[model samples]
Each structure stands twice: as C-alpha cells, then as structure tokens.
Target: MDGSIKVKNLTKTYKGDVKAVQGVSFEVEEGEFFAFLGPNGAGKSTTVQILTTLVKPTEGEIFVGGINVKDNPEGVRRNIGVALQETGIDSVLTGRELIEMQARLFGFSKKEAKTRAVELLELVDLTGDADRPSGKYSGGMRRRLDLAMTLVHNPKVLFLDEPTTGLDPMNRKAIWKEIKRLNREEGTTIFLTTQYLEEADQLADRISIINQGRIVAEGSAEELKRTLGFDAIQLTFETTEEAEQASKVLYGIGENMEHSKEEVTIYTENGTQFLPELVRNLDEQHLSPKTINVKPPSLDDVFINVTNEEKERV
Candidate 1:
C-alpha cells in the first residue's frame, strides 16, 4: 500500500513562451486507477513525461512510490512502467524478442528474461503471436506487445498515456480488461491519461481534467458529474411548436430549460420526483411529448462544462 504517487505545484514552461503545464497538483493513492482527462495539448502528456522522468519539470516536486523523482530519478524509474502515446518497439524484432530485450535491459538474467518474456506474452494474450515479427503485427497487436514490454520488470506504478487510442472496440476492451486485472490482482497503481470520456468514466477511480495547461476539475466521475447538481429531463415533441409550448409550461419548474426544433431539455434538482409534476403540467396544457427521458449528468457533460467555462474566462 506504499506505492503512491504525488505531484505538488508542478509546472513546465517551454521555449517560445509555451506553458505546457502550470501549477498542476494531484495524488494517486496506492493501487488506485487515477485518470488524467484532457484534450490534446492540454498538458496531459507533458505531465506524464515529467512524472516518468522523460522530461524535467520547470518547478515542483514529484514522488513515485514515495521516492522523490528529482532526488533519485533512477529510483523512480525502477518503480514505474510507462507505455507512452507512441510505440517504440523495433519492428524487425519478434514480439517475444522485444519483451525479452526489455527484461534484459531491466537487469534480468538471460534465463530469467526468457521466463519473464513468456509470462508477459501470455498475460497480454499475445502468446500465439509471440514469435511473429512486430512489423507484421497489426496496430492493436503492436500496442499489446508494447504494453507487455512495459510490464517486463513488474513495476509498482504504471503510466499509460492514451493506451487505447486508435484501437478497435474489441482491442480496446481487451486492453481495459488487462489493465483492470493488473490493478486488481497485482495491486499496481495505474495512472492513465486519455481524451476518451467513457474510458476515464469506466476505468478511473478518480478523474482529474486538464485544460489549457492547468487542472480544471478533479473528482470521482460521479462527483464531477454531480457538480452540475441536477438531473436532465429530455422531452421530444412532434413539432417545434410543441417543444416551445412545453418550455413555457415548464418555465419555472426547472432551471436552464432549453428547446431545439423538436426537443426540450430541463435541469431539475430532483428529476425523478419532479417528472410526474412535469408531465401533469404539460398534459394540462395539451402539450404531450413524444418521448421523455430522465438521466443523470455524465462525465462528458462535466468535461464540456468545465472546459467551456475556462475558455470563457480566457
């Protein structure tokens, strides 16, 4: 339970006055699936790079598994595994060769390296293609191999940056299952960064969203979604006229009543409790909706709201 990661006041500035990351701070508890959610160039990669010792931070402190990164970068590296956005495998090498080489680099003996390589290939479900040249592998296959290579040393903390990007649904789900297994069974701390909202929602125990080089919001997916503090009730009508009429009828009942061509959405504090009243009010006005749906706010909604609010301030 001591394999936690901590970052304090992390900042990184580049040439040409580019602030890639600014005053970011967060903590990942031991054995936690922590997600960094953000769009491209939102400092997600920059933060990961700094954490993994691929880049030095301009200012701040970083600790992995309770070892200070700046004080002992090699120690930090020893405790963590990284699967970056780009695959760095040698295509001419077989998948087994790549994993064996990684194990060797981590100081495994020749015999031990082969044993670890076989274990990892099986763990990633690439045992069948272990001897295939990486150049002949598909994109998904290559990704899985890269992930296996990262695990060759049994790292206590794992960093995955957009691990499922460009993968088909089947492959993405396969990777998700592996990641969950690693965290659940191995007790490895996972730090994942991705723009996929659903990925973060499904895999992360807690999510921190970055925008414009700063942390915009941080919470569990449900907590962040509940920051809006309302449920949405959507009403679809046969005509725009009906939607407009329905909006007037629901004017004071819900906040932020929105209407489009043939749909209306209202934000209510307690949508379930208010739904019946809403229906009765609309029915009294002869404005029955074609369909009604009540749903809790989603992580995507929270992301959009937080990023838009940041944009407006800028």
Candidate 2:
C-alpha cells in the first residue's frame, strides 16, 4: 500500500445536480496529521465519504495506501480506520465486548483479540470502564470506544471527523492528548475534519480551508497568516475628538483604515515601523493613544477574507 493518500479532480453531485465537492485535490503524507476545515455545508463530509469509499465520487482518482480506492475499496478499508462524527456502538454490549468483537471481526484470534482489546482500552484511558455497559457510558467515553473499535485492525491511516465535537472542554483536551499519542507513539497517519479553527491550528501539520466546494487556502497556519502581513493596529484615545483627529493622521496606512467610536484600526505592512510614526503623528494632532495593540492576521481572519473574496467574484 502506498503511504500517501492522494485525490485528484474529485467531484460529487447530488440528485438535483448540485455539486457538493468540485475538483478538490490534495495529498496526505505518510504518518502526518492533516486537517480539512470548513463550515457545515462546505463538502468536508462528502470528500471524506468519497475517500473512505462509503460514497462514490462522480469523478476523481483516489489512492489510499497506494491501493486504487475505486478498484478495491475493501482493500482500502482494510488498511484504514475510520471514527466518524456519528458513533456506531451497540449500547447493549459491554465496553470490553465491543472492542473484543471488533478485533475478532478483523480476524484476530480469540486470545489476541482479548489482549488487544485490553491494550486499546488502556491506551484510550477507558480500562476502568471496560466492564460497564456501553449504554451507561458518557459521550466522551463512547467516542473513545468508537476510536478503539476503529483501531482493532491496527490500520495505518485513521480518519477522524470531529472526534471531539460534543465533548466537554476537559474531554476534548483528553481526546486531543490521545490523538497526539496515537500519532507519535504508533506513527499512525490521521486525516481530520473539524469546524473548530483552534483545533485545526493546534493539531494539523498543514491545514486546507474549504468553502463553497473548493479549497480557498492551504498551508501551515503560520504561513497562511504571514501572507496577510502584520495588520490591524488598535489604539485608544482620551476623547472622541482626539480619536477622530488621530484617525486622520494614519489614514494612509490601510486601504480602508477607519477610526470608529474610541479605537483606530489601521492595516499596515510593518506594524512596528508604523507604530512610532503613528504615535508621533497622533501627538502632533494633540491626541494620545492610551493603548496600542498590533495583532497579526489569524487563520479565522484568513478564512473570512478568502471566503469573502470568493463571494465577491460570484
């Protein structure tokens, strides 16, 4: 099986001929944590479904672990573990039973299945709850069990679509830790999809932002943010008149700089260079900037900018 998961010219169309995914292409490297981020209707799930062979693409070339997905989806399934957003667990089964069953279904011997089940429960920190009925488990525990089930085959690649979505803050952090451990210790490749920007920023080695069925941006968080330069300087004023006066002084710093209410925001290339001059100019204008803050563009900002630009073109 090839280590990399590659997709070329992928597209998905519904019955009404509405395109869900359009010509999306990317590569997930061997043993890398890659994230696909977008809003609810942005084709993220459609792409995952196509790649994992749950749904066929209208047009595309997909290779998972070097096996042609279209030709041998079962082979691709054998090599990949998928923990979808929806948990597929039997409430009647005990946690241990669930894991054991998954292992057995993957062709593990009885003894090996039990041992692997124990190991997985321990790794996911659900060992203490192994004897409990799955119906009694919490949302987070259920999610962990779902992931454990997916790993019964020790798949090389894991597809996690919003694994932490409904969990509380603590549970979310706990799941994040387990994900990191799985990647670092077992060297598993993970393809993640999430609506949370911070999750993508924190976990992904590289991020691809999708919108309106197309990839609008792709890069490391820092690299994409750097492209926007250091913009948006915030300033406080002693008085409304003073703020208004300061706004006029640094008007040229941005394409459409503005001073609204109490703060003056200017988009500039070199914030530091512009700061000193801005202060001096404000002083000349008989105004004082009580607080100054310069924030570089963030992934959220980039998402908004790029998507807005796309909307304008239409």
lDDT of 1 at 6: 92
> What would the per-residue lDDT of candidate 1 be over residues 1-314, giving only the tens digit for each residue?
26799999999999988999999999999999999998888999999999999899999988889998888999888778999997478889999999988888889999999999989999888999998899999999999998999998889999999999999999999999999999999999999999887898889999998988999988998887666556778899999888888888889787556677998888767889999999999989988899999987554445555765667789
What is the model-wide C-alpha lDDT for candidate 2?
0.84
The estimated TM-scores of all candidates read 0.79, 0.79
lDDT of each: 0.88, 0.84
| Cα lDDT, model 1, residue 296 | 71
* Candidate 2 per-residue lDDT over residues 1-314, each given as its tens digit: 74579999999999999999999999999988899988888999889888899999999899989988899999998889998886589999999999999888888999999999999999888999999999999998998899889888888988998888878999899889878887888888889999887788788888898987999988986776565444667788777877887877777756336567887777667777777887887778777788999876544445556765567789
Q: Identify the runs in model 2 with alpha carbons over 4 angstroms from their true place.
A: 228-300, 311-314
TM-score of 1: 0.79
Q: What's the residue-level lDDT of 264 in candidate 2? A: 76
**Which run of 10 residues does model 2 get worst, by summed lDDT?**
296-305
